[model samples]
Structures are given as structure tokens and as C-alpha cells.
Target: MEITMYDKLLQLPLFQGLCQEDFTSILEKVRFEFNKYPAGSCIAQQGKACKQLIFILQGTVYAKSIDNEHGYVLYETFDSPQVIEPYSLFGMFPQYTASYHAQTDISTVSFNKSYVLSELNKYEIFQLNYLNVISNRAQNVYRKLWDTHIGNTAEKITNFLQLRCTKPAGEKTLQIKMEDLATLIDDTRINVSKVLNKFQEEGLIQLKRKEIHIPALEKLIEQYT
Candidate 1:
């Protein structure tokens, strides 16, 4: 497990352009702390300040945004190797600005923001890599936001599923939920539920406890594009 995890950290694309010494430098200043959260636990609550950018080592997490009438809408799902959901390195405002929940057993390596940015700013390569990461994340999110605004609930669901779900081995399961699905597509729970019901009625999707079984993934993909 130790070898495999370190190998994963070494091979991460976000660290691709950096050198071995860079990682050593990071490890010197940044401490590796294991954060464990149970299923359905809140890792980062809504409207809170975040002091560290955590690199996911295991499990999945869902990002959500709070709303007045609808409670919370699912914003997106984040997998491992992402340092926090979105880096606040250069954001005009440094607050977390959103919340995240553990969808399953979670583990991460968190780094202090001050030390991280300090090391990153010293190196031109690291700076570019950081910029690239932030740029791509914001742009992808913007595109999704644009799509969600124009598309209906069904279209939003399609867009979200395409971005989040992976076809599991053997069985054709997508394995997400209405609640987290709400975040991924940038829609409300009420709206997501309504669309899920619509899809089930049409024999397109199967909804379960925090999981989704899609019998027609290709067809759902067809609906999007």
C-alpha cells in the first residue's frame, strides 16, 4: 500500500512538470496528514474558510453550493490528485466559497496554503503548472455553467453524468446519487429528483441509494450531444 500510494503521488499529472527535487522540497515543508471521514460525512461544510488544499488519496467527494429556496445544489464531483476542489491561490477572495462532502471513505494529504504558494512562486515551472490547473478547472466549470443555464433538467443530468460517472467493471453501474448529482450538474435536489423520475419512467436510468445504474449510457450520451 505504501509503495502504491507513493507511486500514485509521483505519477500524478498535476506534478508532471515538476522534478523529483520539487517533490522532495514539497515533502520537506508540507506534512502528510491522513484525514478519515465516514460515509456521508461532511468534509468541508458550506460557507466556511479553508486553510489547506487537500490531495485526495482515497474515496470520492461531492462539491455543493448553497441556495435559498432549494437548500443545496450539487456543483461537481472531485476525484483523487486534486489539491482541494479549486485552489484559492489567486482568487480575489480566498474563502472556500462552497462546501464538500465525503461520498465514501476518504483519505487525503493536505498542505498548508502559505507554504504551498511560497514554494510554487519560487519556481517558474511550478507557477505555470499551477496556473494551468486553475485555468482548466475554472474554464471547465464555466462551460458546464453555460450549458446548465441553457439546458433543461434532463440535459443537465446528461452533462453531469458524462462528466462524473465511470462505467464499472462487468456491471453497467454509474454509482452516484440525486444529492451529489445535483452538485455535479449545478442543479437543485428538487430539479434533479424530477429529472431522475422522468428518466426512470422512460427506462433510461435506475436510481438507488447514492448510486445510479444506467442501462442506456450510450443513449444518455446521445441525449447530450
Candidate 2:
């Protein structure tokens, strides 16, 4: 049988572990609105009141943080059938910490904060999973904070490399721009460029305009990490 959008939603972190019966009930009981955004469109802006819990149903979203000196910093990206800023929906002052833009044509279903919270209280498994999601998000932010404030330039660059390095088409590489890296890591473009050059000279990485191919990611990681 072909999987439905409802089935895909059950696979998400927030909705995982829910049986079909319960999932159906929640869908019928809760109120949500679907929204579509074209490619390169802004889904949500930073510091805006987060009144709804948005779940992406299609395409990709690129999240960015505003930097006073460096402009917008690319923080992360998320793909379809996933939640966006669940943590921001709660707390004393709820606001999106980063702006999200559609990387491609995207669709989302959003649940009002009051309704989602009501469901959370009614469902134990959903509540636990929601806590897990928020906890994991918090941990990531904490780690990023440690890396940015405490780690040195070399550490920062290496950490960035470790986090972003991926093997696509069986080739190990990081297809990222130097300027984007600088902005993401809150480092100067010159410093980021210099470190990448040093890594290249040391036979650690091969640099292209927007791609950094690591000969052996383990070796590169071991040197600094």
C-alpha cells in the first residue's frame, strides 16, 4: 500500500511510537492549518512570536541566525516530514531563535500552541517524545555555544569540518563556501581561509571554491579532535 502523508507524519520524532488508532484520534481532535511556500521564500523569521508548531510535509528549509557584524549565519537545514522549532512554542517567552527559509518549494502543517499542548497532556508517549525532541535540541545548542565561545580558531574550524563533512556519491567532501563557513562559525573570512589553506598544505584537505574534499575524514578529525 502507498504511504499516506498521515503515515509519514507518524514517522516524525514528535509523532513516533503512536499507534494508528491514537494517531487517527489526534488528527481528528486537533486543529491545524496547512501552508505552502515557494522556493527561496521565508517561512518564519527570527525573534518572531512562535505561536504554532510547524511540521514540514515537503521540500527543504534552511535555517539562519542573524549576526550583527556578519549578517545572516547559516545554522542548519531540515527536510520534509519533520518538526520546526518545537521548543520555541513553549516557555515564558516563545520566539523563533532563527529564521527559516524554504530551500525548495515546501509545504507545512502547523498546530496552534494551545491545541498541541492539550494533546501532549492527554498522550504520554507523545509528551515523552516531545520532551526528547526539545532536550536533544537544547543539547545541540549547548554544544554549539561551547564550541563557539570556548574553542580556539583551529578547534572551531575543525569542529565545523567534522559537523558538515559528508560523503555524497561515495565521495567524501564538504560542499560549503568559505564565506558561509566564516559566517556560520562566527569567524573572519581571512582566518577561515588561512586555516583551510594550512589544512590543504598539510595534506589534510583538498580545497575548491565551494567544496572541501577530505582525503581521509578520520585523519583530519584525529589531528584536531
Candidate 3:
């Protein structure tokens, strides 16, 4: 691997805190596959078995999750240097929760589950990094359960998005009827529309027929919360 690429890989959460020697040792022992995807190409599908650990090395990836029971689809875009659901590699359901597609021409580095257990897991730093990532995710979700109450309509809507999204900073799209969204947030349709229109006017979001497009979720959250 090129020194530049190695440096980029070191920035990833799973590889952080590792010395150059350990990093090089793991690389020499494990076979890491590098792949490129064009824009609009499907990287992974929801419910597919996650047999490998895929780390986005370049470009952007869009993730979409459909809640058939809830009658909505959530879309989120992730930039490079992000892992695609590392926790999904283990557990009873070992499957991706959302479908992912390349938003732009992208490159990725991946290794199978067998390599993860037999090679990566043997490193103490790797184990600690992996554990911290999973633990932090769990704690964030748990904390959201207690943060359900928001008096302001905008804050409530922002909270709803933050709770559903896997990452707080990203481009997000919520495909649902205004009425359905209002119902979910326990607000009147008129009131929800009013606040959304205000948001659109302030350049926070774009309101379309049955869709709400947030250019930047972090900015939206900051504005409202």
C-alpha cells in the first residue's frame, strides 16, 4: 500500500491509536481488497449479509432505509473515511440495516469477517477502538430515549431527525407526507407546515411534495437546537 493511503487508513476509528509497526504488521498479514465504485452504483443492499468490513476510502456514499410499516424512507449521505456499519458484522442479525450507493465515484478498502476475527481482533488497540465505537453508538441511542421532549415545533422536528439518523452530520432526506410527519411529532399538520415553511425560507430545508430535503443536517440541528 502507498504511504499516503496508509496514512488515510490510520485516520479511521478502527485503526486509530495504533503505532506504525502494528499497523504495518496487520497489513502484511491480512489481505485487504481495494475496490472502486462509480456514482449511482449500489455498494450494499439492506438485509444483505455483512461478511466483510468495508471502509470508504474516497468519495461519498448515500444510504437509504425504508420503513414500510411507518410509510417512510430515510436517506443519508456519508463522506469518505467512514465505515459502513461495522457493528453489523457480528450479532444474530449480521446484515446491513440500510442500502448504500455511491453518491460520487468512490473507492473502498475491505476485508472479510474471517480476516477481522483472525487478524484485526488480535491487536489490543484495534479491540479497544472497536469496543469504544460500538459502546459510544449504544450510549448515544440510549441517551436519545431520554431526550424525547421538545416544546418548540422546530426543535421537535430536528430531534426526530437526529434520533432516526445514524450520523448527526450529513445530508438527510425524509420522504413522508406532511400529515404523517406531524402525527409522528405529535403536532398539528398546519403547525408543522408553518415551521417547515419558515425553515425553507431561512434556507434550512427544502420542502417538496411528500419530501423534506435537508442540505446539511448538522446545520439544521444547530439552527433549531
Candidate 4:
């Protein structure tokens, strides 16, 4: 049990920079329990009190919500070695902001809210990582809102490309397929394909079979914003 949990924790970004000795020491003092969920199950529901912080050890899950008009809206999907709803684990109203469903069979370790808060107080690295997770989540929400409300199809594709491209500067390759990219932006695949072609013709992006290479990110970003 110790060996397995230690290896799993090592994969999580929250523990990324910690040495093995430090990780072992921290785990020795913290209390956590694991659970398994079958595929197509709801892991957590919206508006429920967040008593524990769930850390995904394996499999995939999606945080989704419903709208009167749109029905089920997928906010995001997460793969293994990730934390769920770190931002909602605190504050006066510490409740899940969206429902989480297991897209595949999932294994998770949950730390009691009190246990996590206590550990955060004792470890600077953990505290920093916690803050980073929450800050990044907030920024993602802001970006999604901006893209949905203000961005046109071309701008939306460009913004999504920039976020997924993963290069600091200069040319970068996009590995996502057109269908998946369309689903991500909540747009039609035909429109996305057309936009990609337009960008290709303009020399902003080059599309190959199952790959997209951005030549001038500055030009693409200029159009995005």
C-alpha cells in the first residue's frame, strides 16, 4: 500500500518538485483514503459541501454542468495525476461548483479538508502548489468565459490553439485532431476546418494530416485578442 501510494503521489503535479524523502515524510503525517469509481459514474455533485480534496490517481473524469437551453455542458475533462476542485475546497462556501463524472474507471485518494489545511500550513512547497492550482483554474475559467462570450469562431480557434500549442515563443505544433478541436471550442468541425484552411493560406498556420504547425504565433495571437 505504501509503495503504490508513494508512486501515485509522485505522478501528481502538486508533488512534482518534492524529493522522495520529503514526499515520504509528508505522506507519513497526512491522512488520506482511496476510492474507486466505475466508468460512467458521478464522482461528485454540484453544490455539495467539499469535505475532502479529491486527487485523481488514475483514469479520466469530466466536470460538467447543465443549462436550461444547452442541457449538459462539459466544462473540462481531466486525466490521471490531477487534483479536482482545489479552488472550491476552501472559503465560507466550500461546495463543488460543478458535477464530476467518471469518463473511465477512476482511482482517487481524498484528503480530509482539515488534514489538507493542516499540511498546507506546515509545508511551503505544498502551499505554493495549492495556490498555483487554484490560480490556474481561475485563469482558465476567465479564458473560457472570454472565448465563449466575446470571441468569434476564428478568434476562438486561435485562442484554443495558443493555449494548447505549449510553446513559449516561435513555431509550435498542435497535436489535436480537427474533430476534437471542434468539440473543445463548441463549434462545428466544418467551420473549424475552414478556419484552419484560411489560416494556412494566410501563412499563420500550416495544416498537415493530423497535425497543425503555427509559423507566426504573434500574427495568430494578434487576431485572437
Candidate 5:
């Protein structure tokens, strides 16, 4: 693929702060490689080498794996132009716990590992994006450890609920399902159920089956904090 595909990345805050002319040398090294996987096909496997940085240009992908019981848990999803790789990439290590699978017919623009690093050293903008990759991961780690195990079920429910309110153009309704939220929070569905129900009964939230709506944003955040 051509460098034109990366034009979308230019609009990002990290990339917007950059001038294309300044990074022309990097784009010369950047290339898009096409690959197709049918829906439900594993794109990258666990414990394998992650030799490329994939930015899906079309369709959807899933970061998924099974626990001891062998139930397929969808950990995360990636749409077009979104980068998908484990934390090991920044540390320049082998694969991590998760694997990526196509949730639909998909294609991506991959970066040569050496090219990416070369660009990072040559361009400050790419360097910021590189740091961003690690910063986001660190935030995720903190969210997981945030009083979750120490707090009551209601507190845990509130913690996850905060994200819905903060989402870009998010409605009171959380567009995702309880089962998915359970995996993201690393909690059992039963525990998630108990927590949600308790919060709902206390009038902290309004649960309309699959939709978890927050009616009192300020009060809810206060309680969770």
C-alpha cells in the first residue's frame, strides 16, 4: 500500500502536532502490507514473534484468548487505522499473553520493525506516539489495580461505569455488554451481576437489561472516587 493510507494518522493529536514534511523521510520507509483473514480467523497467535506493527485499514479485529475453562473471551477490539500489539513491542520483546484475531474480513498497513525504530529516532513526532503506546498501557495497568479488589462490589461496578460517561460522544448507555465488561475488568460475570444489581437498587445506576445507563453523573463519580 502507499503512504497515503497513513494520512489518517496525521489527524491524531500525536500526529497532528507533527508536520508531514518533517517526517517525509519516515514515510519513505513506511509501507502498507495487505493480508486477508476471514471473520473469526486468528491473525496473530500467542507466544509468537511480533515482527510488525499492524494498523488495520479496514474491518474489525479482536484481541482474544481462553481461560482455563476454555471459554473464548474477547479482551479488546480494533477497527480501521488502530494499532494492535502487546506491551512487549516497546520493550522490544517477544509476544505477550494475548493474540489478535479478525472479527471481520480485514486488512492492515504493517511497519517494518527496523523502519519504525529508525523513524522514531529520526522524528520527534513518531517518538511521542511511541511514548504514547507505553503511556496508554501504564494507565490500563493502573485502572486494573485501582481499589478494585479492596472495594465492595458496588464500588467496582461504579469504577467501570465511569468509562461510559467519559467516552467520546458517549450516551448514558454503555454500548457494550456485561460479559465483555467482565473480561475487561478481569472479574467474573456473576460478580459483575451482583455489583451492577446492588448499584441499581441503591439508585446509583439504571439498568435496562443490556444497557447500563448512568443518570447521575456527578454523584456517581463522587461515590466511585
Candidate 6:
């Protein structure tokens, strides 16, 4: 394996604390499947079984969750050195909640469930790191439940984005109609537009047709949260 590939693997949450020797040993035992994807390619489909742990080594991918009943599609961007739904690999559903598409030409490395259980789980650091990742996700979702009541249109809009986002900080693009967003936040279209316009003016976001581009999602969260 290339040194750069090892470096990227080390950056992942599950492999964070492994020593060079330990990491090398594990790698030797497992056959990691490396793959490349072109921009606009569908990497994974929603509702498909998540049989492997896929780590994005390079470039960007967007996850789209469709709500057929509610008639809305939520899109969240995940950049390099991020894992795709690690918690979903062995859960009750064991399926992807969102469809993932390559936003740029991307490279990914993946290991099947069998290797994860037989090899990765044996390492104490890997086990702890995996638990931490899952625990943090659970805690985040739990905390959001208590943050249900938000003040003002601006805060509501920010809260909505924060809840749906995969990460707290990133360049985010929300693909939803103005009226639909207003409905979701329980605010009037005029009020939502006013707040969004203010955000755009402040350079916090760029409002395009049926889209709101957040240059840095953390800044919006800080301003509103």
C-alpha cells in the first residue's frame, strides 16, 4: 500500500489510534477493495444493504435522502476521509438511509463485514474508536430531540439544516423550495425569504433557485445556535 493511502486510512475514526506496526499487520491480513468513482456517479443507493464499511479516501460525495411520503429530498455532503454509515453496517435495518453520489471524481477503500468482525474488532483501539463514533452519533441525535423548540425564523432555519447535516462544519447546499422550507420550519414564506435574504447579504449563504448554499455551515450554526 502507498504511504499516502496509509496516511488517509489513519485519518479515519476507526483507525485513528493504531500504531504503524499494528496498522500494517491488520492491512496485511485484510484485502481492502479500492475503487474510483466519476463525478455524478451513484456510489450507493438508498435502502440497499450496507454490507461493507466504505471510507472515502479522496474527493467529495453527496448523500440524498428522499421522503416519498412527505415529498422532499434532503441532500448532505460528505468530504474525504469520512466513512459512510458505519453504524448501519450491522444494525437492524443494515441498509443505507440515503443514496450517495460522487460530487467529484472520488476514491474509496472498503472492507466487508466479515473482515471487520474477524480482524478489526480484535484491536482494542479500533473497538473503542468504533464505539465512540456510534455513541457520539446517538448522543447528537438525542440532544437534538431536546432542541425541538427553536426561537425565530432564522434560528429555525439554521436548526433545520443542522439536524439534517452529516457534519457540523462544511460547505453545505440545501436543495429545497422556499415554500417547502417555510412549511417545514412552520414559518411564513415571506418571513423565511426575509431571513434567507439577510443570510445571503451577510455572506453566510448564497440563495439559488430552490437551493441555499452555505459556505461554512458552522458559521451559520454559531450565528443562530
Taking every candidate in turn, the Cα RMSD to the unseen true structure, in Å, is 6.4, 5.7, 1.4, 7.8, 6.4, 1.7
Tens-place lDDT digits, model 5, residues 1-225? 345554755644335566656656556666647677789888777667777776666787766543334233324555666666635565656574567788899876566577666664577766777678678766755775675554655566556554322221112445456786687666788888887887788786777756666555556657666
lDDT per residue as tens, model 4, 62-167? 6654333422232455667777777788888899877888989999898888877676457777777778877876686566566652467798876765453322
Indicate whether candidate 2 or candidate 4 has the larger TM-score. 2
Could you say which candidate leads in lDDT? 3
Give per-residue lDDT, candidate 5, residue 116. 65
- After superposing candidate 2, which stretches have Cα over 4 Å from the reference? 1-3, 69-72, 143-152, 159-192, 199-224
Model 1 lDDT per residue over 126-183, tens place: 6776678788766766665566545887887776555432221112344454676677
Cα-based lDDT at residue 133, candidate 3: 88
lDDT of 3 by residue, 68-106 (tens): 887999999998888999989998999999999999999
lDDT, candidate 3, equals 0.90
Residues 1-225 of candidate 6 have per-residue lDDT tens digits of: 568888998999889989989988988998899999999999889999999999899999999888776456767787898899998998789999899999999999999999989998899999999999999988997776566547899988988877777788878777788998888888899999999999999999999888888989999999888
| Worst lDDT 10-window in candidate 3 | 143-152
lDDT ranking, high to low = 3, 6, 2, 4, 1, 5
Candidate 4 Cα lDDT to native: 0.73
Which candidate number maximizes TM-score? Answer: 3
In candidate 6, list every pair of residues with a backbone clash: none
Score each candidate by Cα lDDT.
0.63, 0.73, 0.90, 0.73, 0.62, 0.88
Candidate 4: the clashing residue pairs are none
- In model 2, the clashing pairs are none
Worst 10 residues of 5 by lDDT: 162-171
